[model samples]
Target: MLLYTESKEARRDVVRKEHDIIMLIGDSLHDFAAEFKNKESTEYQRGLVAKEAAHFGNDWIVMPNASYGSWSKSELKMWNEKAEK
Candidate 1:
């Protein structure tokens, strides 16, 4: 059996061992594949998503994320900043 490091795709080694077609379902892009795990920049990652628009909902399904998401890297502030301290 081939190890994940030995495989080209970022899929798990166990998944790689299978011969059947695989469909990925996840809340994050990286959960689907490493190509979506680009470390360059968020813009670049979005660009990649645009490039693979056709594959979305067809090949891999992205589930909804209920909690705080990974897309927002900005410094967070209190939702309600009070006035007249």
Candidate 2:
């Protein structure tokens, strides 16, 4: 909800002040929208990011944090591993 609200406010800023969105900076997918929120696999998230590949660096700035993020919670079904006793 906060993300959506902030997105809307950002858009409103552009419309009301005639400003240009040079770039968007964030450390997590939630910074963009619920669609990119914690879920599915990293590949799926990468696919979503690919949709805006051209805008990367040019208009979108994704900050990285090794400490933690949604990428950590995202499930990876292709790891190919199991519990062994």
- Per-candidate Cα lDDT values, in order, are 0.68, 0.65
How far out, in Å, is residue 2 in model 2? Answer: 10
Candidate 1 TM-score over all chains jointly: 0.61
The top-ranked prediction according to lDDT is 1
lDDT for each residue of candidate 2 in 1-85, tens digit (9 for 90 to 100): 1345455445546555765656667787655545675577778878988886786777667788889866677665554455431
Q: Give the TM-score of candidate 2.
A: 0.53
Clashes (N, CA, C under 3 Å) per candidate: 0, 0
Q: Which 10 residues in a row give candidate 1 its minimum summed lDDT?
A: 1-10
lDDT of 1 at 21: 43
